[model samples]
Target: MATPAAYDGLISHAGSLFWIQSGEGPDQLVTWTASDGVSLAAPQGFELGNEIHAYGGGAVTASASGVWGVSSKDGRIYRLTSDKAEPLTGHTGDQLGDLVVRGETVLALREGTNGDQLVDVDTSTGHVRVLLQSSSFLSSPRPGPGYVAWLSWDADHMPWDSTQLWVARYDDRSGGSLGTALLVAGGHSESVLEPQWGPDGSLYFMSDRTGWLNLYRWDGERTYAVAPMAADCAAAPWELGYRSYTPLENRKIAMRARRDLEDHLLLVDESGHSETFQLPFTAIKPYLCTIDNAVAMIAATPTTAPAVVLVERDGSYAVIAGQEPSQDEVRQPERHSADGIDFLLHPPIDAETTWRAPVIVRAHPGPTDEISLRRDPQLDFFTRHGFAVADVDYRGSTGHGRAFRSSLYGNWGSYDVEDCAAVARHLITLGITLAGEVFICGSSAGGYTALRAATTTGPFRAASARSPIIDPKRWEASVPRFQRAHATALATGATAVSSAAIECPVLLVHGLHDPITSAQDTAALASDLKTRGADHELLMLDTSSHTLAAPDLAAQVLDAELRFFRRMLDQSESAKRT
Candidate 1:
């Protein structure tokens, strides 16, 4: 029962670290100081979460003065004190998130049924005023001395696919209204993210103008490339408040560059001279904030769990939230490349004691996501049970250039499926797995790929899909507005998986309350499989979300998956013996 606690949304203000913690209990906002250590910022019964985009981030913001966050129970902004939680907004039915503080205003991105709006909440009066509201989506509403910068995109594009960086002057004459806006950078092909105001009053942002997301500086009049590199310095803006880099003291920049499927921390100077700093972590989250001369991030190693680490200039760090787990006898990944696709192959733990172990081919979700060499408890569970796991970074994965990621724009189903199958075949050729013992599993988009592979490909003996998208077009219609465009793009050439074509034993597990993928569609697929007499089992969890992040539910899922795979393996072995 490995219920590893989860940490996210790391930020620093006035030498105090604030982050969101879950899994130990209800999700809570935690504040850490050198003097007081770690303590809950909210009351004991209060849970903090942001639901702006369905998949929320940047739910809380803090400074030396006070701490403010959006409550998960009610999608309203709340100001937290020592023991009291006061709601600042009425029951407007609008979700507020991506919280930031500037002057005396708490700026947040408000998502309502009408659309998205960038608004400011007065710290003293709790007055909500719309700063700008025309784009279909808005994020990162950063307020500076005399200007406000944010990222906006239309309904036809995801923030990563395309976005525009805009800045507007603040007119204090009429109680501080945003004046005429200026298009600083970004267009249809260019994606911009993390607009931060530097100490020198220049706006710093990450843009993929040259097909690689690099650092740039905007001095109001013109934009200049600060440190241009082939590697991407930003991630897909799946959630708000994503910061890949932060401007430090003396015009210096601390950033995480994704290269070779891992994150490397680098320091960029005023002259664009970059230096790499070695650290114990290989995977870094999409949040970075500066504390004094050091940077705080949610980072992890291949063997250690994810933690809120305050990293110094010389690459040394101290844990702020989660502690570093033990590294004893951890199974390291064997990086492999097959057909220009990258994957991390983890052999069964104690492989010497096993004979012809089965292999699990994992298709990562997002279909646009990448799998780093981080410590994954699920992967460890499979390997410890005599199962080799192949964590495939199929096409459309980030960290690679924009071309590689957008290659699946209209070819999502085919390209990603082919890549995963190619990795399994490559493993078979290397004698790491047997041909008849290959299994495939995925969640969300990856689950769709697993179902497609089991139906089309022969090497796979069993398949597992959790909250899978049985019908792409249907999914596009059911998903939130923020993901509708991206889903439509990915489902351009993909059709629904036909249950009648499934021959291999399949396991379907879906959370009834999954917000992203359609749970009703999964149930329909289960019914279809049953009618067709397909060998399958459907495990419907009553209270799990998309990831089944709960400890007990996650454990149940892992145990069920292992049992299903082993049953198939035993049946195959018995047939061979007969």
Candidate 2:
């Protein structure tokens, strides 16, 4: 079966629901209503995306006038209507993202080589005005009655590492400008995200002041926690326009609280009283908004695909978009913990013959990214091929609070490598996997972990890394300006891998156009492997980027890894017979 279409940036305006759907072609703006079901917000061929902060989001916003979107082809905002699309922002070198409608103006973050600025675009005349400018990067420009609030941070820090929320009086009467501002929250040690305006006029946001991202509100003069739960109410701001919660009527807040890598729907109040609802979906995407007295969001489960879901007051939810796979097509995992690391262990689909089956230990990318209970097609493919898959959510993963997320700060290579090795050893002790049949694989940061583990005295029989970072110091120097410091921080004590130390079979697949990780460095490592006569293969793709945009190429890479593992297993058996 084909992978399901992806949905994101869910929002509601004037009783109509709007979101972005991808995986079919270009990311298209979709609108759904009770009467009309689901339809495209803009005509086909008019794609929507943004490049602000390098990873763009919050590209579409709707007002009474019409819908507005940022063009992925060109860095410009387009007013998307049913009949035609028009450019609202001028064709400049600047890129605008995180579009939010306030009054007659659309507030967005204008990113340029100079710096980032908060700009306002007039919906009526398509005129643009600069509201606020900062040397630091800016995002989530939330405009209230007479004030504008947004997130700002220095180049040395990622948004999740450190951020500041500032609010200033904005006047768009003549040409937009900002007055004296007040620092609402966030500092060097504290990370804040998703500042939004409530119906009560209070500014709401998520802060990790108490070691977890919880709901907090600023009533102009004072700031307090709306919900003081231990669960995190937000994820890292990898993209803009991610709303973790929505303010509802009667002082109620519908929040997607993440705990243990799973998202739970919670209804919280100002008094800190909260109620949890049982839902079919275990994973919920950002940008939750109110619709007809209920909450609407993009959510998924192990048996279902990510869809635009309208969750009602009674806890019943209806999928407005996307489809669900058959029960036989997906398999759930058993939660396993080793050395404080959480991992999902999926036995082979044909469990009856998995007694001596080989195990695939997989590491998720981001190093900060977590593995949820959502259905993944790759896992299905591996399990179907009589392989037990273990998805490790090692230290530094999200959903466990800030302290755990920051645990890998100075020990990126060490912590991730040890944690992945620990999971494999634990499986061996449990008799779930054999020592010589266990393999580790990952991409990007996770790939770094796999390479490091393979060099160590671990149980990993072989290793596969796709576009892996072999040299942290080199990777830190070549990454984007916004993430340069982040890379340096992650590479604090990381050492470059030695090709001579890798004894087992290795498979390396890299895209030539990967901007984050250097393909040249990967090529250099491949040369070293060849000089040492190590059993390895390096597959290079000319058309793909960091993320393989082509589905067939991704499948080809997966099949290549499977073949590499099977060939190694056969070699081991032959050696034993000899």
Candidate 3:
């Protein structure tokens, strides 16, 4: 069976809803209505994915007339009608995304060589005009009645590290005029995200000032924290157009909260009283918006694949679109009872096996991101083949509080490597797997962790890293200007663990066109391994990017890695018998 496709960019229009269906081919804009079940708004090969923040989201927005989106083939915005798509903005070198339509003008965030800024485009004339500029990054341009609000930050801080919320008087409908942007909230150590205009004309946003991302509102005077909780109501601003919370009618709010890697849907009343609803889902995408009395989001559980679901205020939900996983395809992972860290242990699917199953400890990408309790087809492939798996939530991962996530500050490789080793040792002590059969694998940041783990005294027989960061010092040059400090902090006290110390065989996979992590780093590491006479192999993909959006390439890489693992395990077992 093929892996399920994911959905995002949920937007509610005039009695109709639309979203972007990704993962299969080029992302297609899908529209749904009560009259028609579902239909494609854009033609085939008209992809909506963009590269604004590297992992772009919110690339599509709906106006009264039609839908406007950033074309994946080009960075220009297009007005996608039912028949054909027409360009709304002329081509510039700047990457445009996070589109929001306001009357006859469409506002978008443009990332250029100068910096990131907000620009307005005429729907008819396709004329682009700069609205705001002189910021390292800008996002979430929410246009209200007579004003527009947005979030901005400098080169010294990431969006999640520190951001400033601003509001300005914008009157583009009457000859296009914009006022001086005034600071609303943020600019401290707190990270603010998703500045949106509420139904009551107030500006509502999420802030992490109290160590947790909670909801707050600005009533044109003072900002008030509404329904404050110890859980994170917002995800890291990795992309644009993520909405963790949305305002409902009658001063109520519908939000999603993250605690211990599990997602909970919440309804908060005006008095700060919250009602948590129990659902089978463990992870819910932040692409959420309220429609009438119900809320729509893409949600997924450990056993169930992601689906676009419309949940009512009464805790009842219906699947709008997307596939659900079958019972045989789902595998539940048990939480490990570690002392202080969080880890999940997934057993082999075949309980009738007599031999101890080989274990693969996973280190998820975005050393800052955590592995959610959602159904992953790749991990399930290992389990179905009689191999156990452990997903480690190393230090610096989200879903925990800020302190836990900030623990890896200036200590990236050390903390993550130690955490993976600890989990592996714990599994071995419990007799879940033998020493020679344990393996470690990861992608991107996790790839760095897996490579570092092989240098430690861990019980890992082999390591596989996809698009891994081999040298932290070399990685600093390729990151964004705002993330240089983070890269420096990660490389400061980091020691270059030699491949000679790693006795286990290694498999390295990388995409030649990866913009985030350079392919040269992987090639250099492979060279070092070869010079040191270390057992290693490198696979290079020509057309794949950092995320490997192509399904065929991803499947091929997975099959290659699995085959490498089986070969290494067989060799180790043969050596033991000899």
Candidate 4:
């Protein structure tokens, strides 16, 4: 019952025994200790500079500390306690993203893959302290010594338009700067994102006006309402890399759903109390694992990928099943080529502490690069709501090799956006990630590499870009002729650019019955991000087309993207003292 690639990743030491972020090299993070199930010692050469597929957080702590991660050229923060690995550089802005950890200090929350430095590193002292920036897009870093709550959007085009809800509190031993950001709850026709912070401070997030997708709380002083809109929701508050574990107790906030029905393990305390643990296993894919005292996850099917059975704590479930999931010796088989590139790396199972998981970069669609991870129960509803997903086949996108899928013929968006931003900055130098809270999704040519990763090279925080072909001269002057001969080499190297140099906040879902990315090219790409202003939001749905992965339109696009990233990511600890 363990031969689906051996079903890697359930608990090889507890963290990432066999976690993956999609194929290729230099992005190590492979563990397997407890005395070898197949051997995976790890650590050597360790190089991820200039970054390629980078995304590793900053902590294995109980051992490795002060971590923050991300790459494809920058956004690092390291301070590994034992085994010496100090690499904190303040903040220079290249790649590093939505990350957290305040106790021993390591909160890299960034977004400037090009402009807007949201810095916060100190991992002992590489000292990069900025705290805020323009055209923002942050989330992760909820509670703090004095204060810290994030979820912002000063308006990029319409990115959930007119958004706000940012909390701050300087002097956490002197890291000052965040005097203004009051406005707890804006108009929110499109914003009020994911502000977590549970344990007791009570922040819990995810909102969508009243339309659906619910789960809210604020109590740093006000904002109440607790759980209702379920286009498919379950007490929002993710961290475990996508949405795997958010157990907070007393005030409660458990989760592990399949939305409407079927896959269950839902909780939601604080007053909302929404119960359901039922599990005999039908969960096509669910993974909200790890919360200590009790809360583990892993449910699979699509030929199979299970390890699940551990529901414990009065409830009962300690079923081991074959015994797989181990690969976090912090992998290093060592291999990387450049002539047309050849890479290799499939190790990342930090054995728990908090090693991070979810990567799923996978984007081909450019001339059918087909790479596969097929199944689709919304990928098991994003691994039963806890994500450790990964998949990427870049080089112009396809299954692999054909001159690497014709090298995007004339460089269609430069080697599949530099091999999907070099395999997410090579798994952020192999720590597995503490920064780049990437969700660089795709659809039409991987939604043009998740909309060219919000204007070429990002420190990504969420990009659910479905049906995006992104201006290849407006898709070869409006497609047609046998699909414009398979998009004449990506509209002769795509030209009509201008999603206003894209400054992050996009949620653009499409399909008013999309035939081939046309609902007037997503309403003229949301009217060219409102004539080049940029911070967009589109959502068309209805009869919906262009397989958004399906399963009831990927459960109404993961419930308006966890309520448009929980109102862009709330940070009000009750306005932190406004």
Candidate 5:
């Protein structure tokens, strides 16, 4: 009913039930159904928040006897009971943070927006307990009801060198007195990410201890690696990103993993047996779910995003749930037929509401062969702001197989640039975009290509990029700890076309916290742009990793881009009017 809601996490009660909020809805959305999958309804007037990095942060806080939906929006515990849904915790001024429910009592744990204090409020008696009120911050609870698992933090919030996992048990009827908190798991070079309980009472989580998001299980005694993925398992970390699972127990635990390096799902059993399959869709999550050891899961294929696919123990597939976006809602870019190769043209959502939208042609990072419209939030944000962004599945992005994806091979800067120009040329001919008004941009590998096109083959006047993976030689020697080896993957074979190819009036945003590409590398590149006499400005976001922080920071980068295009293309009025 809305413009594509991202169903990141899933849980089941008596019948197949889930909690969902619209992708563009506010933070406090409540669209849950009964246990029977009947009566799918959303709470009136309460929309889900579109804040930064809080996917699946809220949950259904139900007890064994009675169930209630809970959330930490506006510092209040908005609940859905047998009658009308209302606030269960907090008076009028207090804001509730992250909380869970046990039996009859609801414990709403609140730490101020910036202050450091854990305020535990009881849902039944309205009693409050200040648990270790400190000046430091506590990260979101790692979600388990009876076993309340939380991570400790100090003032810095810069990630603890050695953080410990703390768990506590409590009965609401007695008192909000959380049982003795004890450190159950700790002492790792890596941080503890999303922890889920298996059907058999084991704690399952993903850690980069081995440089990849691998599966690990923990009882009270020790944590063991459930399944070890390939070395390239994580191109990045699990910080605010994702992985998948819905365990009945640790034994019959079902999980979806990133295999072959993209967002594909895999099936894993307790014995550590693993089977890789093509997810129904590359974008939506493919979760392996089960009950009482008999398995069922909602998976997607390349054809669709997360159509609920249940797996039988005997290994048969069944599509049980979830909705697919209508073809019209999913803006499929027109395929431009040129040079015996057909390219997909993806338009932004804002294009549908208005006409003559400013089209930005983009070159993807990977030059692997295929036709793909990789769903990216950044891209969506562009559309959300009312720009028609068109990305090229030109000669190289992967999915069509290796041949198409690897077309650029050693010629990264040159070939992808050509594709960008070609897409622009085709779009102009198709009459979707004006030739002079189209803008081009990309990041890392794609950034290089965008700037290259702006100078050499393309007519676009402005360019924007994020933490570009420029100067292969410089990048290789001084990359981040996790991506030292991935430098070679930038090209198929090796060598050639220089950075001199990228000469556009560029707006560059780099992250100082970039461990992947050195901040020095970004500065050096910017200086080189000046020496080469290109009209360029470089701004860096503090404490931000490559993706940067959310909301305000991301808006700044984009607004700068808006100004860049407006100045050069002379389309501010057109941009404004649209």
Candidate 6:
């Protein structure tokens, strides 16, 4: 019963509904009662989490003059009302986030050091007002009824590799300002996203011009696509109100796409007709919220785990909050077709196993991210311990489009270390496991693709990596000068594989306040694998970060990575009986 902390801002107002449960501590803000669920902020030293573009979503939003969020200890912009939450932007170093509110003003998305604009605060004198600056990165500002749409993108694109969708004109006669924005769709090589205004004001978005990521509608001068399909109704904005579609009730829409990696739920209608709806989820979160024809969403189901649901147009859905993962602790993955590689295998929850189980694989940390058949209790704790997970959606991932997500752009650590050694040689050519029992884990660009798959592979008999990036040229000197040109276009020309070309046993784990991969780059690659003697073993957690969000330091870093993969599979079965 202790597994509920995976729900995000699922808004809806006037009918009363809100979400955000940042798991366990700080970043709560619940609210929904017909049987229970309240919280509304503060239950452990304030935090609503929103670091803006450092992977912070449209942290909390709801209107009628209440609930606005973004605090995670001073990135500013609060306003909870009735239950008291305060601080409406004093600009404590200006970070703010993708909020919206309007009608007392909120608009947000600031980020500082002179980049990312579209301001507006002032819910009563917290005064801010920039309204729109040239973008290098800005995001969904979305105001309506006089115009104020948003989303920019440059610095060589990565809001799914391209974005634009402007549209200004929001005046409020002098005290608001925002007029010359224009550029409707997106720049060439499409990738627009979530603009939204509808109910006759017409604008709605999510593009990817024919290469997937569908749904469109403009009406200020004609655009209309509404539902195209190849799959991928949005994702890869990496933050900011990531909704795949919304705008129901008589104009009907409620989307959510993605293909081979699951997630369905369509419902178009308004004369365009679209239907797909066989519920039991497969990962559906991109903020839907609507309440009148009922929509709301937070879904999940590879054996269920995330829940906030609501849906109703006769598809009948309810959950309203989380919890649902017991079918003997659910495992369900099976989808390994190979070819250009797209994974998800999970076998071994206890299939009368006598041996042959040690598998792992994993690798997902946005080397441009992707891997969502949802409910991952750390890949079900490696198939309930007997181990057999695979989960890689490699080749730059992201619901597979944009030429398989630009094939890992400058080849991030060589196409995610050859898609984790082609899913460990298609899971040992389908016999499922063998070849030194396979292993390879990842964290943070999949810990630099599990230390670049232990230096160009031996089909991994040992490798764990969290917080890795041992040295993509010294990790592009800690990127963030507006993402050092996307970390120099994903580590320009790749090739850095070292740790002395690892031959086996390596564990590494890091998190001494990982502000984006740096526990001294896993203590200088465990001090150069202890000056070349190699056979690694680092650890170091001192109160984890880089999303290890503490659940007893993520079960002591998964019990020190299942005791370093069972002492490297018992020293490879004691070197095969000597």
lDDT per residue for candidate 1 within 362-397, as digits (tens), equals: 998987788977888888899889898988988898
- The segments of candidate 5 whose C-alpha lies over 4 angstroms from its true place after superposition are 23-42, 48-56, 64-73, 81-83, 91-98, 107-109, 113-121, 131-137, 140-147, 153-163, 168-188, 231-243, 277-279, 286-461, 464-503, 506-578
RMSD of each: 1.6, 1.6, 1.9, 24.2, 11.0, 20.9
User: What pairs collide in candidate 6?
Assistant: 243-286, 366-369, 443-447
For candidate 4, the lDDT comes to 0.49
The TM-score of candidate 2 is: 0.97
- Please give each candidate's TM-score: 0.97, 0.97, 0.96, 0.28, 0.56, 0.35
lDDT of 2: 0.85
Tens digits of per-residue lDDT, candidate 4, 1-578, equal 11132222232223323222212234433333324433322233233222111222322222145323333333354543224445666455455544455555555555443333455655666667777665434444455446777665432222222345667774445657865655556454534545566666666665555643355777777988675634334222112233433554566665654332234566666666677766444342323444354565555332234553456556666534322333222222223332343333222333244466544454545444343222333444444444444555456532232244445656776666676666666666665643445556677767777777767656565566777776776666565322343466566656443566666777778778765666566677678887777666788887645656534566677777656544443322234456
State the lDDT of candidate 3 residue by residue for 1-578, as single tens digits. Answer: 57788788888876677898877667788988768878988877786768886677778888786789888788888888666888877778778888888988889898888788788888888888888786577889999878999998877677877888999998877666578888988875888899989888889999888988889989899888888888888877787898898788898889989877688999987678999887777889888887766888889888777898878888888887975534664457778855577888777777443436899999998777777888777887888888888998888888777777778878988898888888888888887788888899999888888888888776898899998888888887778664665677677777654677666788999999787888887888889999988889999999648866467877878888899899988898899899
Residue 525 alpha-carbon offset, candidate 6, angstroms? 1.6
Please write out the lDDT profile of model 5 over residues 1-578, one tens digit for every residue: 22334453344444444444334434332323324443433355453321212222334444443444444355455556433566655544434434445455554444444544444555665567665454454444543546666655444222212345677774445545567888755444454555566656677775555545467888867888887765222222112223256564345555655433234445577667876554334443433345434444444332244444445555555554556423444454444555544555556664654366667776655333223434455556666655677656566554333244435546677667776777677767767777667888877667666656656756676777777766676765675322333455554444422346565577778888776556666677678788988778898888545655345566778777777777766654566568
Sorted by lDDT (best first), the order is 1, 2, 3, 6, 5, 4
Q: In candidate 1, residue 92 scores what lDDT?
A: 83
Clashing pairs in 2: 243-287
Please, what are the lDDT tens digits per residue for candidate 6 over residues 307-391? 8878787887878667653455565768876667888887777755333577988888866667888767777776788888888
Clashing pairs in 3: none
lDDT of 2 by residue, 1-578 (tens): 68678888888998999988878467778888999988888878897887777778888999887888999888888889765788887789777889888777888888888889888888778888877778878888998878889999998898887999999998666574698889999999999999999999999999999999999999999998999988888888888889999988888999989877688999989999999888878888877999888999888887676878888878888887886434664556788899888888888877863465789999888877888788777777788888998899888888888888888988988888888889999999988878798999999988888888878888989999988999999889888767777798899988888898887778988998887788888888889999999988999988547866356777888899889999988988998899
